[model samples]
Target chain A: MKKIKLKVPATVANLVCGFDILGMAVHDPYDEMEFRLLETPEIIIKHIDAFGLPEEPSGNVAGIVLLKIQEYFNLKNGFEVIIRKHIKPGSGLGSSAASAAGAAFGANVLLGNKLSKEEMIYFAMFGEELASGVRHADNIAPCIYGGITLVKSTHPIDIVSLNSPDLFVTAVHPQVEVKTSDARQILKKNITLKSAVEQWGNIAGLVAGIQKNDFPLIGRSLNDVIIEPIRSILIPKFDEIKAKSLQLGALGGGISGSGPSIFMLSEQKETAEKIAEMMKSVYTEIEIESFVYVSKINPSGIQIVEEV
Target chain B: MKKIKLKVPATVANLVCGFDILGMAVHDPYDEMEFRLLETPEIIIKHIDAFGLPEEPSGNVAGIVLLKIQEYFNLKNGFEVIIRKHIKPGSGLGSSAASAAGAAFGANVLLGNKLSKEEMIYFAMFGEELASGVRHADNIAPCIYGGITLVKSTHPIDIVSLNSPDLFVTAVHPQVEVKTSDARQILKKNITLKSAVEQWGNIAGLVAGIQKNDFPLIGRSLNDVIIEPIRSILIPKFDEIKAKSLQLGALGGGISGSGPSIFMLSEQKETAEKIAEMMKSVYTEIEIESFVYVSKINPSGIQIVEEV
Candidate 1:
C-alpha cells in the first residue's frame, strides 16, 4: 500500500481522579490524515484546514512523530503527510495526541506494521511532549489502545488496558484555550498526604468500578482532589457546567485534559446527549461558540478509512 | 443463636502501594473467641492467653466494640466474652482487628445477626481506635468482607471486596514492637506530587491486576513508594528480606501494616512455604524470635465454629 488514510480519534485524559494515568478515546471529532510513502529520504506536510498548525516537520505534532519513525527504522525513504483536523487544537481534548499517535500509527502501517501498540504510544509521547512540554502517555496510550487505558509507568512505558463498561460520554469544547504547559504550572509541587490518600482511594475505586461495570461506583469515584480544583478555575463557568451536569445525572466529569473542554460520563446515551445539549446551551447562553459531542467510548481507535 | 464461638482470621494491611486503603485476610493464626448473651446490660471479658491485654471493657480492643454494640442497639442485655489471641499484639499483623472484628461478628450473631457487614466494620472501628489513635478499616474491612478488600472511604464506611487470585502469602513477624501510632507518626504529613502520582498509578494497577486475576501484573504493582521507604527502616533486615524474597520467585510484598512483620506474595504454595522457611532462618540468624506463617488468602473472614 502506497497511501493510507486514517481517522485518528480524540481522547479525554485524567478522567477526574487519575491525574497522570487514566484516559479514554471518543468517537466523534477525529482528524483525517493521509500518509503517502516516498521513494526518496524526504518529508513533506500539507494542512487542508485553516487551523494554521505548523507544516514544518520538526514544528508539527504529527511531523515530529514521523521524524522519529524514520530514524528508529533507519529508513532511506520517508513519507508525505496531508492533515485535516476537525478536533480543534488547544481545545483541551487530545488534538495533539491524535496527530502524534496518528503519525506513528500511520507510518507503522506504511512500514508494514513494525511497531507494537506500546511502541506507538512511546513514539507518540514525543509528539505529545512537543505540544505540552511534558512526555505523558495519559492521552496517547488510550488513543492507541482504545477503550480505557491506564499508564502505570512511563519511564519504560508500561500501560494497561482496562475494561470499558457500557457508557456514554458528553464532551463540550468551548472556544477557549488553556495551554497545557500553563495548566501544569499552576499546580503545587507538593500535596498533603491526606489528599494523596483520598486521591488514590478514588482512583482505585474508579478502576474497580469500571472493571465491575458498577455505574454508581463509577460516579462516586469521579473526583479530582488534586488537579481539578486549580485547573478548573481557568475555564469559564467550569463549576456551573460540572455541578448542573451532575444534577442532570452525569456519572461525573471534569476538565477533559488541561481544559477549555469538559466531558462527563453517563449510563444512557439519551442522558449523554441531554448533557451535551445542556452543555451547548450553557455556552450559547454565555455567548460562546462551542462544539459538542455525544459518543459511546471508541473501542477500536484509529480506523483505516482508505489504504492503497 | 444465644451463644457464638468465632474464629477471626488475621489480616495484612497496606499491601505495599495501597497504604491505608488495601488489605487481605489470611487463614492462619486465627483468634478463638466465644460470646455469651446475658439477661442484663453489662459486659464481661476474659482472656485465656498470657498476652495480658487489658480486661476492662473500654480498655480492651474487643470490649470497646462490644460497648458500642450495647449502646448502638440500646440492648437490655450484654454479653460475656472469652478471648484467646494467637496473633500477637504490635506484630504489625491485624491482631487488634481480628479481636475487634471478632467481637462485632460474635455480638451480631448473639443479637440475632441484626447488623450488616458494613455495619459490623463501622462498629468495629471503635475497637480499632482503641488500638491506635486513628480508626482505619484497612484491616477490619478485609477481616469482615474476606479476600482482598479496598476501603475506598472510611467515612460513611465504603468498602469494596476485590477478587483474589490463587496466590499464596508468606508472613514473618519478628518479635519487636513497632507501635502503630509511632510508625504512623514518623511519616511526613506531605508528599511530593510526583510521588503521589506514582503511588496512585500503582494503586490503580494493583486494583486492576487483582480484578483480572493477572499474577505478573499484581507483582509489578506491589511497589510502595511513599510508606515502605520510611517504615522499612524501622524493621531489621527489611531491605535484604524483601530483595531476597523477590529473588526467590516471590511476586512482591512489603511491611504488612506498620512493621516488625513483613509479608511476601507468591504464585505457588511451595514457593510461599519456602519463603516462610527462609524468613525463619533470617530471624534465627539474627537471634530474634519470629513467628512464620504460610497460607492461602482467606475467603470467609470470620468463621463460626459453634452457635447455640
Candidate 2:
C-alpha cells in the first residue's frame, strides 16, 4: 500500500483497583494520522492539526514510534506521516498513547500488516517511553485492541481485551497540568498487607464483574485502596468531583490515570450525560476551561479511516 | 424432617494469592454428621468417630454451630448430632469448616430450608471463630457454596462462587501440625507496593481464568507472592513437592491453607493421581504418615446422604 490513514481512540489507563494493569478505550477525542510512502529511507512527519507538538521525528511521540518501527524492520522505504491531534496532552486521557499507537498501526498497514498485534504494541510502547520517561503498555494496549484490556505482565507484555457490556463513560479534563512523574512519586513504596488484600479482592471482583456483565458488582468493586489515597491529593477539588459524580447516579468515579482528569461509568447514556454535567461544574466554579466527553466503550481500537 | 445425615467436604482456604479471601471445596475426606430432632431443649453431640474430639455441646465445632442456630431462631427444640470426623484438625484442609458448615446446613434443613446460602455461611463462620481465633469465612463459604468462592469482604461477609471447569485436585496432608496462629503471625504486616501490584494482577487473572474455564490461564495465575513465601517454610519439603508436582504435569500447586497440607491442581484425573503420588513421595522419603486425596472440584458442598 502506498498510503494509509488511521484513527486511534483515547484510552483511560490505570483503572481503579487495576493500577498500571487495566485500561479501556473511549469513542470520542481520537488522534488521526495519515501515512504516505517516500522513495528515500527518511521518516518525515508534519502536524496537520496542531497542539504545539514537536514536528521532528526524535522529539515527537508518533514520530518516535514510527522511527523505532523503521529501525526494527530496516525498511528501505520511508514515510511522511500527517498528524491530526485531538486528544490533549498531559490530561491522563492517553494522548501520547493515541499518537504512538496511530504511528505504529499506520506503519504496519503500509507493511501489509506483517506485524502481529503484540508486535505493534511492543513498538508503540516506545512512544510512551519517550513521552513519559517510562515504558508502559497499560494505555497503548487498550488503544490498539479496543474495549477493556489487561496487561497481565509487562516483562514479556501479555495483553488481552476483556469483553464488556455496552457501558457509557463520562470523562472530564480540567484546564490544569499534572505531571505524571509527580503523581507517581507521591505514592507510598510500601502498603499495609491489610490494604493489599482488600485491594486484590476488589480488583478480582471488578474483572469478574465486567466479564459477567454484572453492573452492580462493577459499581461495588470500583475502588482503589493502594494508589488513590495518595494520588487524589494531587488533583484539585478531587473529593468534590468524585462525591458529586457518585451522588448524581454515576456508578463510581475517580482520578483518571494521574490527575487533572476524572472519569465515571454509568449504565445509561442519559446518566452519563448528567455525570458529565457534574464534572463540568467543578471547573466552572473555578472559571477554568474544561472538556467533557460522554461516550460508550469503544470496541474498535485503531481503525483504518482511509486506505490506499 | 425428623432426621438428616449430611456430608460436608473438606475445603482449602487462602488459595495462594487470594489470602483470606478465596477458597475451594474438594470431594473426599469429608465430615459426616447425623442430626435428629429431640423434644428436650438441650443440644446433644456424640462423637461416633475415633478422633477423641470433644462431645460437649458448647465445645464441639458442630455442636457450637447448632447451638448458635438454636439461639438465633429461638427454637425450644434441640438436636442430637452424631459426628463422624474423617478430616484431621490443623491440617490446613478446613476440618472445622466442614463440621461448622455441616451443623448450620443440617439445622437449616430441619427448619424447612428457610435460610439462604449466605446466611448459612454467616452462622457457620462463628464456628471458625471458635476454632481459629479469627472470624474468617473463606473456608466456610466454599464448604457451603460447593465451588471456588471469593469472600470480597468480611464485615458484612460478602461472598460469591466463581464458575470453574472440571479440574482435578490432589491434596496431601502431612501428619505434622502448623498452628493457624503461627502461620498468620509470620506474614509481614506490610508488603512492598510493587509486590502488591503483581499479586493483584494474578488474583484478577485467576478469577477471570476460572470464570472463563481457561486452564492455562488458571495455571499461570495460581501464584502467591505474599503468604506462601513465609508460610511454606512451615511445611516439610514444600518446595520439592511443588516442583515435582509441576514437573509431573500438575497445573499448579501451593501451600493448601496455612501449612502441612499442600495441594495441586491438574487437568486430568490421571494427572491428579500422579501429582498425589508425587506428594506422597515427599512423606514417603521421610517415613512420615501422610494422607493423599485425589479428587475433582466438588460441585456439591454439603449433601444429604440419608434423609427421612
The C-alpha lDDT values of all candidates are: 0.92, 0.87
Query: RMSD in Å for candidate 1, one decimal?
Result: 1.3
Please give, as one word, the docking class of candidate 1. high
TM-score of chain A of each: 0.98, 0.97
Off by over 4 Å in 2: none
Residue A129's lDDT in candidate 1: 87
RMSD of each: 1.3, 1.3
- RMSD of candidate 2 to the truth, in angstroms, is 1.3
TM-score of each: 0.98, 0.98
- Per-residue accuracy of model 1 over A1-308 as CA lDDT, tens digit each: 89999999899999999998999998988999999999998889899998999999999999999999899889998899999999999987799999999999999999998999989988999998898888999888888888899999988889999987788989999998788888989999999999999999999999999999888999999998999999999999899999989999999999898888999999888889889989999999989999999898888878899999
